[model samples]
Target: MEFKFSPLAYVPFVSVENMIKLVNSIGAETFMSELAVAIEEDFKRWELFDKTPRVASHSDVGVIELMPTSDGEMYGFKYVNGHPKNTKEGLQTVTAFGLLADVDSGYPKLLTEMTLLTALRTAAMSALVGRHLAPKGSKTMAMIGNGAQSEFQCLAFKAVCGIENVRLYDIDPAATAKCAANLKSAGVNVVSCKTAEEAMEGAEIITTCTADKQYATILTDNMVGDGVHINAIGGDCPGKTEVAEAVLRRSDIFVEYPPQTRIEGDIQQLPDDYPVTDLWQVMRGEAEGRTHDRQITFFDSVGFAVEDFSALKYVRAKIEGTEFFEHLDMLADPSDPRDLFGMLS
Candidate 1:
């Protein structure tokens, strides 16, 4: 039996190779800047989206998570995993894929590789928040834990927040060298430092992005100064944290969702009832961002699902007239309604 599939059965799919091509074609800095705008648009209307913490299954080795969200009109989700040991085995510490669907028909509209997209979106969101909370006239950023995410963080800050100098430091000298080399032509001053404190010197914005599965203090209390905005992104799961308890207590912490941040972010080190500001409220003008130049501001980012939804939405729009994706026949469309089994035969 020859079966004809309807156009609805085909969904646009962006593979990993194609995703790389798309980023290169559009330019990484421009892509992240535009993506930040999309994420900000969603953040302003944060009340309209369905929100929850990502569902995660954890093990001694790593964790696998599903992040899902919807804006009443469109639904999206990303399947991702984190394994710190993967790097020792010559594999990525994190990888992901995501899908966007139409709410009316519940049919998938787009599917794309999200590993690269996640890095882009995470950096973009960090820089977006920096633009709001960092001290006025901020130019230098301290990039701690130079790894897969370091260069992207530097470039995103340069593109979105107008950061001009990025001081890089990591436990591994090779990693710092790799990051500096990659950012050589990225239009920012790349400074390699020996110690974390050295990196933070003269830096107004400090971004910590280490990959460890345990409670580790990457920043101590005395190390942090007033009038600095801390973008803490490395500690994103239970038992994995980067900042010290004293530092969190002193800073005015802002989070994406309290329920989630209390469990997964650097704020996890604080008491459950500890007060924190919501980033959405700030975006919506309901809460204050940076009140005093001498005050410390902290952004405890846990990578919310709505941000991923926004990134997927941005990719869907950008790839409309471009050859950055292919049609994937992923649904069953029987010529006769309700005859799915017959079409299979």
Candidate 2:
């Protein structure tokens, strides 16, 4: 008799180099578009997931977080750390990795680098939510923080929301310069602005993604107009926020998850009972978004675990029949089911 078995005993691992190659092979714009679809599909089925706020261990300097979720079949989680001052030492401010596992067998399926994937899925989620909440014909975007995630946001808006012009600004002029330089060939009109107000000129979408940990106000009440949409990305985690509390009071707020956003998003500055539309409800057509053209809309994004689950699942499907992943011998297999000691011996 011939014996044959599948490669189910091993897990697949996508390294940093392979993740980069996968993104490049898929094209950044197309990848963002597909990722948006993946995120939306999960959001539409939000009720099927087990959701919770990311577990975080905070310190005076930075934080480490674990975001986990499961759909009763596959489970995924990301291990991430954020240290804003690390860039001064020529290191990334944030780094991450994630894994997916089988729920029935409690076996690992995939392990992958999530730093770049996080940036991509975050931008994809912002643009996706913006598509539903932003005003009609929003072509220009003001990206206030020109850090590692700036360029990805610009491209994501272009791919997902049809944004044609991106205005860049940062406290560090070199950061703005780098963002602008990176967007030269991205097919969008890139403008480096001297101030946040200048960056907001003629821009219909305002994205405040600064990396400060304090309760600093990046977008004042006066800066936001009546019709524009605000993507508040920077103010994640406790004691961190980008938009002014006054601005929040006047806007139609939306969130990924209320429990998480209350603790980790810009809405943390608001009252615990403040009303907000869950983005999943809007995606599922159970709730409304952007009812009027003059109504201000805010997506208080805190990076949900479901988005990571969707991203991991998408990568898992995309890497099949491709050489982008390597088999990791992480699982133990014994020839005899009840002879674990004998197999080891």
Candidate 3:
């Protein structure tokens, strides 16, 4: 696993093609499971990390954000954009890249495309929370959004929580068909449903991930039953949400970070002081998860910086001694450290 170059001077880059090959080589299920373990480990040590809400710049059609965190030794940040309307033009709704840097040197150690990594980490985070919060012996999940992220969520749950079946529903029938086709040989049963209610049938975990700009209710109060874990991810920016307000009132909510969730998660629809359990605390055993079989546990996921940092760490470890990553000449090497013109000369 030794590097060919001095690690400080060369940043490893994982492109989309390389990332695809990496996932295929490790098998998607195994990669998702390992990534989930990485995320859980980071969450357990959350107190050591500097946490903050994502900084966002919004526009009429989309929003771009910078999510950054540090653990005293290393710093990581992701540059991501979300455009819900992009799908109409045959483009991805989310695109991202990220960097991991040495805290003291302030020099990047790795630069990688995060669009694929984000999907992997997000699914890992969701399924990891499901392992801790979902009904015991849960085997089925209802996925309400059948877009780009649907397949990853399905496989991650199957790998980590033993979910054997997924009922898929989307407003666009073609999306559901595409998702079902993609999951045909994924080793989990894929059911294409006509409505959200149909998708929820016999599902112990309900995941809502619709892409919309405004507060849209993908799941209503009546549709959500007791004893189910709700994974809400699409409501990542202000004014965007997927679950009903009443649903939030009935569930014991869990969040990555309360400060950010209040602005971007489904809890944004609730009062400022509404109760929430930080998921990291649950991982650290400072708080309880799924105290009762009938209790509704909700993971108001907004995709945190720490999760991205963990994913970056996992990718770096997995790509070492492999050709999945390329070294980029991102930093200038100067024999005279203080001479500005020495490197060029």
Please give the CA lDDT of all the candidate structures. 0.93, 0.92, 0.92
Please report the TM-score between candidate 3 and the true structure. Answer: 0.96
User: Which RMSD does model 3 reach against the true structure?
Assistant: 2.3
- How do the predictions measure up, each by TM-score? 0.98, 0.96, 0.96
| Model 3 residue pairs with clashes | none
Candidate achieving the largest TM-score? 1
Runs in model 3 with CA error above 4 Å?
Answer: 1-8
Query: Which window of ten consecutive residues has the lowest lDDT sum in model 1?
Result: 1-10
**lDDT order of candidates, top first:** 1, 3, 2
- Selected candidate, larger lDDT, 1 vs 3: 1
Clashing pairs in 1: none
Clashes per candidate (backbone, < 3 Å)? 0, 0, 0
* lDDT for each residue of candidate 2 in 59-103, tens digit (9 for 90 to 100): 888889999999999999999999989988998889999999999
Question: What value does the lDDT take at residue 307 in candidate 1?
Answer: 91
Model 2 Cα displacement at 41 (Å)? 0.8
